[model samples]
Target: MRQDRKSLAWSTLLEIDSQPEGPLHRKLCGALRSAVVAGRVTPGSALPPSRVLAEDLGCSRWVITEAYAQLIAEGYLEARSGSATRVRATAAVPNQGQPRSNPQISVPVEFEMLPGMPDLRTFPRKRWADAVREVTASIASADLGYPDVFGHPRLRERLAAYLVRGRGAAVSADDVIVCDGTLDGVVRLCRALRSAGHTHVAVEDPGWSRLSSAVSTVGLTPVPVEVDRDGLRIDRLRANTLTRAVIVAPAHQFPTGTVLTPARRAELLHWAREVDGLVMEDDYDAEFRYDRRPIGTVQGMDSARVVLMGSLSKTLSPALRIGWVVAPPRWAEALREAAVAVTPPPVIDQLAFAAFLDAGWYDGHIRASRLRYRSRRDLLLKEMASTLPDLEISGAAAGFHLLLHLNDCDAAQAVRRAARLGLRLVDLDQYRMSARTGPPALVLGYGNLSDASVPEAVRRLAEAVRGKGTGTSCG
Candidate 1:
C-alpha cells in the first residue's frame, strides 16, 4: 500500500551528489531549511531518524546528524535527547512583508452580554491547585486506571451527598453517572431514550437552540411547547402524549428567567406520571440566587420520572467539562450503556473534584461566587435604572443574566445596532423556534464584565436603542 503523505514526506532524503553548490552536509541542510521555509513541512512535525535518513541517502549517520545540528543551531528545528527531532513551532514560511493572496478578516468584539457565562475571574485557582495536589498525592495507583465509566465511586458518593443537601436532588452514588459536560449528558440521555422507542422529545419553544439541534442530531423530533410566565405550559404538554421526554430549566429558565410556579411544577410532574414520560431537569444556574430561596429541583419530588443534569459550567468554568446525570435506579443500566458509547472525562479531574468537594472547597467557592455575582447583579440593576428606566428586567434573583423586555423596538434591530457600537448582545427572538413570538426582549449577561464596564456597556446599549451615536471604544 502507498504510504501516507506525512510518512512519505518524512522519508524523503536529500540528493547530495546532484547538488554541487557546497559540501554534502551543507546541501542537506539547505534542502531541509528550504522545505521548512516553504511550508511543505509544517512546524512541530518530526523528521526521519538520522540513521534511517543516512541509510536511505547512502551517507554516514554522522553527516545526517551534522546537518540536523546545523538546522537546530539556525533555529529552524528543535531537538531533545531521546526524542524525535522536529521543526520549531515558529517555522511557518515567512510572508516577506507581502499580504496573503486571500487574507482572512476578523471582527473584534467589545462588550459581550451573552448569557450562561460565569465570572471566570472568580475561580479559586489556589484552592483548586491545592485540592488537585492533595488528591493526586492521596489517590491510589489503581484508581488511575480506566475510570468506572459511570464515575469514580468516591466522586459519585461526594456528588450524591452534595446534590442531596444543596440542590435537593434525590440520588445516591449508585444512581449517578459522570459525563463530559451537560451537553454530553443530554446527548446520552436522548440516545438511550431513542433506544427505548422514544421518537419525540418536547422542548420549550423559546429554548436554547442547541438543545433542539442536539435532539434532531440524535434522530428524534423536537416538539416545541410554548412557555408562559408560569413556565412551560402544562396544558400543551398534556395535549401531546407521544412526546416521551421534556427538557426544562425550571430553576432559572433561559433567556426569559421565569421560575416554574409551584402549581405548574406539580402539574408537570403529574403530567409526567400520567404519560409515563421523563423530565430532563436542567438545574441551570441554581446556585447564584440573590433574592429568594433556591428553588428545589423536580428530581427531588419524583426521582423515578426526573433525570437531573447539572454542571460546573455555570458555577465554575465550563472548560473543566465536569457534570453529572442523576437518574432513577431502574435506568442505571441504560445510562451505563449510553456512557460507554462516549469517552468519559479525565479521571484525575474527577478525583480532584471529589477532593475539592470533600474538603468543602466547592461549597466555599459557591458561597463566595454567590456574593460576587450578587454584587454584579446589584450593579446591573442600578445602572439600568439610571440609563434605561423603561427597560423591564426579570430573572435577576438567580443566575448570571437577566431578561430585558424590549418595548417599542425590534430586538433583532437593537442587536445589530448594539453590535455596530461594539457591544455584543443577544435578544429573545433569536431563541424562538418559529417566527418571532410575543414581545421582543434581550438576555443581558453581566458575569464576564468588570464592575466599571457593566455600566458603560449598558449605557452603550441604551444609546444604541435611542438612535444615538456610537461609543468611543469597546473599553
Candidate 2:
C-alpha cells in the first residue's frame, strides 16, 4: 500500500508541465516542491532514491540527483545515513523565483566566425563515454552522497597535478575550488572581493564584454585599462589607485591575440604586490598555440597575489560547464564559501573528469585539437594573402581566433555587408568596455571554418571591404 502511495507521488511529478525552454531539472524541482506544499507528500514520508526515481520518470539519474540536492539545500528534503531521503517539515514553500530572461537573440548565421568557440564537431565522444562508464561502475558510495562544497576531493587533486604540469600553475588540491565555468568563477570571485572591501576592479579595454557585466553584477565598478601592443598597460593600472583587483587574459588577449610580454608580467606582479591587490587570470584558449610553445601562466610567478581560473570549454565542450579556480591561501576560503552558497556542480561529472584526467585522455584530446586548429589557421592566412592583401592580420601566435585590422573602413558597415553576403563576423567595437572610440578592427574566428570554405569567406569579406572604397581585389 505504501509502495502505491509512493508511485502516485512520483506520478504527480511526471504530470507537472514544465516550460520546454529551460532546464528539465529545474522543472522537476518545481514539480516536487509543489507536491510537498500541497500535502500530497507529507513530511516524514520517504522519497525514492534518485536512480529509481529517474528510471520511473524516464530521465537521467544526474538530473534527479541534482534536483534532490537543490531541494536538500533549500530545506525541503532531508537524508539520513543508510536511509531514504525524506520530505522535511516546513510551513513555508521556498521561493524558486521567476525564471531569468533568455539572452539569446536569434539572428541569421551562415559562415560562423564568432570568437570564443571551439570545434564542436570533433569532440571525443567515445573516450568521454568510456570514462563516464568506468567512473559510474566503480564510484564509491560516498561519492554518490552530497559532494564537498569545495569540489570532489579526487578531482581537485587530479586537476592540481594537471594544472601544474600543463599550465605551470603553482597549486595544490586544497587550493582548487571547482566552478561551473570561468564566468561563474569570476562572479563568485567578484562577490568575495567585494566583501573584502574591493570597490573597483580593472579590466582590459576592448576586452570580453561579459567580464564587465559580471563585475557590475557584483556591485563593483569595472575600470577599463588600455591594452597596448605588449598587453595591458601597467601605467594605466597604476594610475587607477581605487582599483585593487584586475582580470586579465594574459595568455591570449581576447579579440586581439597578444601575449603579455615578460616585462609587463613582472610589472603586473609588482603592481599587485605594491597595492596589495589581486589578479584574476582567465587562461582561456592557452593550449592551442600554433607558432611556438605556449607561455607559462602569470599565476606561476606569484600565486599569493594571483588567482588562476581555467575551464575545458576550449579544450573539450563548453556545454560541460566544468571549470576551477586556484586561489591564494588568503582568498581560497572566501571563494569556496561563495561557491558553496550556490548550487554545486554534479559530483558524477566531476568524478568522470577526474578519471579522464587521470588516464591522460585530456592531454591526448588537446594535442588532436591543436593540430586541427593549426591547419585551419594556416589555411586562413594563406587564403587572406591571396585574396585580401590590404587587411592587416594579427594575433596568429596562439588561440583559435585572429584579428583583422580594417583601417579607416567602417567596421560596423563592413560587418553588415558580410552578413548580407551570407557570412557572419563580429568587429572589435562589440568588445569595448566603454564608448571610447578606437581604430576599427574585426575579429575572425577560424575554429569552426572548414578548409574548403576559408577562401570563399575571405573573398566575401574582401568584397565587403572593397565596397567601402578600399579597392582591394581577391587575386
Model 1 segments beyond 4 Å from truth? Answer: 1-107, 436-438, 470-475
Specify the highest-TM-score model's number: 2
Q: Report how far residue 464 has shifted in candidate 2, in Å.
A: 2.3
Against the correct fold, how does model 2 do in TM-score? 0.77
What shift in Å separates residue 58 of candidate 2 from its native position after superposition? 37
Worst 10 residues of 1 by lDDT: 99-108
What is the lDDT for 329 in model 2? 88
Global Cα lDDT for candidate 2: 0.80
Error of 1 at 46 (Å): 37
Tens-digit lDDT string for candidate 1 (1-475) = 2123347444354334455597677788888887778766767777777777777778887567657755664557664333467777656576545544322212347788888788888788898888788888888999888778888888899999999999988889998888877767777888789889999889887887667656654556778888878889989887777896999988988877888989999998998888888999998888878887687899999999999998888887988888999988756678886565455678889988998898898999999888888898899899888888877777748888888877777777777777777888887876787555668788889888888788789888887666665432110
State the lDDT of candidate 2 residue by residue for 1-475, as single tens digits: 1234355547555445853455778878778887777666767777887778888888887567556655664557754433566776542533344234311113345588888789888888988899889989999998898878788889999999999999998999999998887877887788889889999999998788667655654556789888888999999999988998999989999978888999999999999999999999999788988888877899999999999999988889888878999999889988766664565578888988998998899999889888889988988899888877777889846789988888787888787777767778888987776554578888999887877788888888788766645454222
Clashes of each: 0, 0
